[model samples]
Target: MVQRFDLAIVGGSFAGLACARSAALRGLKVVVLDAKPDPGARVRTTGIIVKEASDEFDLPAGLMRKVRGVRLYAPDDRALDLSAPGYFFQATDMPGLMHWMADEAARAGATLVYGKKFESGLEYERGVALGDIHAGFLIGADGARSRVAEAFGLGVNRRFLAGLEIECEPLAAVDGRFLHCFADSKLAPGYIAWMVPGVNATQIGLAASRPQRPDLGGLLRRLKAHFDIRDIRVTSRRSGLIPSGGVVHCLGARRVMLVGDAAGMVSPVTGGGIHTALHFGRRAAMLVADHLGDRGIHPVVAMTREAPRYRAKLLLRRLMDLGPPNALINAALMTAPMRRLAQRLYFHSRGEKSESFEAWCKAFEQEPDAKPHLKLLT
Candidate 1:
């Protein structure tokens, strides 16, 4: 027997789950499918929720740890600390977060089917059929290499950064107040290496453009210069391809649409997509619901108009792909202009002037038990 749904989403991660929850809550019958055995299985992204995302979404406080500053290091080990007064990043328990999102979607009446691989689908005039299920509207919330895009002949991501990460027990020597980042052309090439003090573990990761590979060993070695790692024990590892290209040319067709990484809704420079994925995922649900139920504007046309172009970020990605020399980075990193640019990139327009790293640390030490709160917005 073929089950039917008003909306069907592939992939059970952030985008797909977000869309499913919104659609179902709006009275639409929603079904979500994924190849993973469970929502938390084999997580990919680092799950760093930026200030904007935290403000927009009411995420669980227990699953996240707030990081108020960024400690950026040049190749020669010189560091620059950056922070905005009201802005902070959240390092999450990725698997736990995914499970929570899935539970929320289920609570909102979305049917989630894990361990189901989406092989192929037939899009007819009325709906799209996937195996034994028929959906009025089909959404591809799949990863960077979306089989849906390929099957639909939609634009695919051409440029990519290969990323590798390892999660281990929290390193006591490493300061938990800042997200430690290292810029080294020789080690990370096109991208940067990072150490995030996540909810219960320390996440060490790196990404690099095409020809270059992320060197986890090299990153660990570099970390030794600033912190002790002799007794470190890795618990889990993850690797995946990040889309460094802008949004795809074609986002959707008649009754089918693409959201999240499938549509290349990712920042080319930072390689961050969770924010866009969540934002656009919920947006896609609204558009789909309106178009399918209320005779509104075509979702494809509306989504195309609303999607982010990332023109400047794409240009920056191209430049970063060239990989700047270590000597040049060491020379220019501490300059006033470079510092201002870094501040802008990390904190945007949050605060006019940032407090010194040492001062911030001293203040945080005074309030040892204080924790950052989520500034949720309506």
Candidate 2:
């Protein structure tokens, strides 16, 4: 028997779940399909939630660990500390977070179907049909390599960063106060390697431009200089492609739309998309609801006007793809001008004249709800 829904979303991840929840809550009969057996299966990305996302979304606090500073290391091991007083990044328990998000969406009356792959769909005058389900509006929230985009002849991501990561038991020697970042062109060309003290584990990962593979072994070797890694116990590993070419040209059609990584809603330089995915995912639902229910402007047209055009970030991405020499990085990294640039890149001018990082940590620890044990180096 053929089923019917007001909205159908492919890929039950961040964007899909966010859209489904909003659409369903708005009284749309929403159905979300995913190839994975469960919402948390085959997780990708580092799951780092920026300050903006945390402020905007009501994410569960128990599944997140707040990191207040960034320790950027030069190739030669020199480091620069950066922080914005009121801003912090959250390193999440990815699987747990995904499950929570899925539960929230389901609670909002969205039907979630796992282990269902979206191979193809037929678009008619009224809507789109996928296998046994007919939907008034279809949304593709798939990953970087979107089959939906290909099937629908929408713009696809041309540039990408190949990323790999491993989650391991927390290392005692590594400081938990900062997100450790390494800029080594030889090891992670076009991108950076990072160590994040996540909610339950330590996340070590890196991404490199296409055609050049990220060297996890090289990153581990470099990390040995700062911390002992002899008996590290790994928990899980993940890898995926990150879109770095900016937003796709065509975001949607008559009764179909694309959201999240499928639409290239990722930052070309930082390769971050969670914030945009969550923000735009909710917005897409609002627009789609209006168009479908109130005869308002087409969601596609509204989304196209709202999508980000990362022109400046794309330029910076091109420069990063060149993989500047380590010698040049060593010389320029500590310079005053370079420091300013690094600060701008990491903090985005959100930092004001504030107390030292150590002082901030001391004050943060005094907060009644602070996780002091997690903040200290063991």
Candidate 3:
């Protein structure tokens, strides 16, 4: 007997759970499968989500540790500090966050299954292996290595921004309300190292475009020295890849769509994809809902039509990357306040929220051309 569903979400991480919750809220039947039965999916992420996006998704307030601003330190030790109006929060209590989402989905009539490996072959229609069951629509919220996406031939070619970090006792002087970043050719190249504040400790990590070829020991030592960190007790260490190729197309097939890291939705420079993933995860659910009503799931339609808004932001990020890291930093600091406004205008000028069709049109809007290098903030 084939156990069908309106949506079968693969991987019950942040993206998967968000997708399932959104679908179930609309009274759609959702089945989420994951290989781990643990309440928290993984400890690979620093788990920082911006305040606006967090509020938009209704993530609980208690789960976050508020951060006031950011400090960027150059390799030479020069620092550029910036402060925003609001406080950013860290997703520290991921176990609570994940289980809360799962409970919400279950309450909304979604079925949650754990320890299930998804399989595909000629024996099944959609190639779903659910022990003699099938699904109507499949969503691949799996991480970078997505079997479901491969089964559908939706390829992902991403240049990952490599990162490694150790969680240690909190810095005595470092405020838990700010994130500190270190950049240079020593610890990281083409990427930066970060000190993320946590509840009782700090998560110190460094990332490079070239992950496999890095001096992890030296980087950690430099981090300890630069931050004046002492009496360090290493609690946890993590390393992972954040897709930096911008958003790719062909995320969907006959009855499947990919969201989050599986879709390569990470930012180019910062490599932050939580917001993008959250936004698009809900989008996948809505598309599934539309498909159920015979509206049909338009994979290319969303990518070509609606995805460019994200692509536009990606274009801005790419342009930012075109300049050398130092130059980029200078531009962020030196760009006259008006030009700063123009930077936002030059990139996000189209509108805050772009529709699928309008996004296609805006993709052709070329305002800020790539500069020769990260020269003194022109």
Candidate 4:
């Protein structure tokens, strides 16, 4: 007997579960599939998100810890601290959050199938067929190396950053309320290093571009030399891939759609995606719901609407990769004016009149002395 569902979701992570719950809430018979038996197992990502994510999504409050500010360190040991009175950088218990989302998805009427991987699928005139399970619409919420994307001929992630992190006992000297970021081109070219304060410990990690040879292990030693954290004890270590190239080449085809890293919805500026994932997950699932209801909301339209912001960020990420991290980090973020510009970009530089991406990019091109660095926009 062939099983069936109104909406089928692959990968039971943040985006997958969010999509499942949204679709289920829309009265769809949603079924979520995952290879992992446990939602929390083999957790990746640092799980640090911006304040806007917490404001936008209804995440579990108990799993979140708010940090006061972010401190950026240049190679010369020049540090720049920036924060608003009310803004926060939140650290989340990622694995626990995933588990909670899975449970919530189940509660919202999504039937979750664990320990089972989705195989190659077939498409019919009405819907796509996945093994014995026929789904009216299919959503690919898998990670960067998305099997669902490959199966549907949606292009794979063109580039990636290798990330490594270690969780350690909190150092007495380092403020537990601050998130620190380091930019040293020699240590981590095309990317940055960070120490995020969690509820129980500190997370130290570095991400480097794929093409460059990075002295990743030496980064920790350097961080210690800079910060005086010689007594910190290690609790755990992790390494994973961070999707680059912003948006994927294709997000949806026919009744098939992709979200999260599978769709390359991560920020090139921060390597953060939880906010983007949740935003798109809800939107994509709603589009699917509308499509099933015979509304003419095409996936192409959704992709078109979402592409501009990711493209702008991709351009910024490319500009950051053009030179040594030291050159840009110190030049762009060290000074007061630069930090003010950074604030605008982070907060809302999207023009006083129109909240368009071109206006946001104008924030860079229009800056004084930006011609030498930000000539691309003109």
- Overall lDDT per candidate, in order of appearance: 0.90, 0.90, 0.66, 0.77
Predicted candidate 4 versus true structure: per-residue lDDT over 210-301, tens digit per residue: 87645657887887776778887998777777787888777778878888888888888667877878888887788888889777578556
lDDT of 1 by residue, 59-155 (tens): 9989998998899999999999998766789999999999999999999999999999998999999999998999999999998999888887888
Ranking by lDDT: 2, 1, 4, 3
Which scores greater on lDDT, model 1 or model 2?
A: 2
lDDT of 2 at 276: 94
Give candidate 1 regions above 4 Å deviation. 360-378
Report the lDDT tens digits of candidate 2 across residue range 84-104. Answer: 777788999999999999999
Q: Model 2 segments beyond 4 Å from truth?
A: 352-355, 362-378
Cα RMSD for candidate 4? 8.9
Model 3, residue 334: distance off in Å is: 7.2
TM-score of candidate 3 on Cα atoms, chains taken together: 0.79
Candidate 1 collision pairs: none
State TM-scores per candidate. 0.95, 0.95, 0.79, 0.86
Better of 1 and 3 by TM-score: 1
lDDT of 2 at 68: 81
The 10 consecutive residues of candidate 4 with the worst lDDT sum are: 350-359
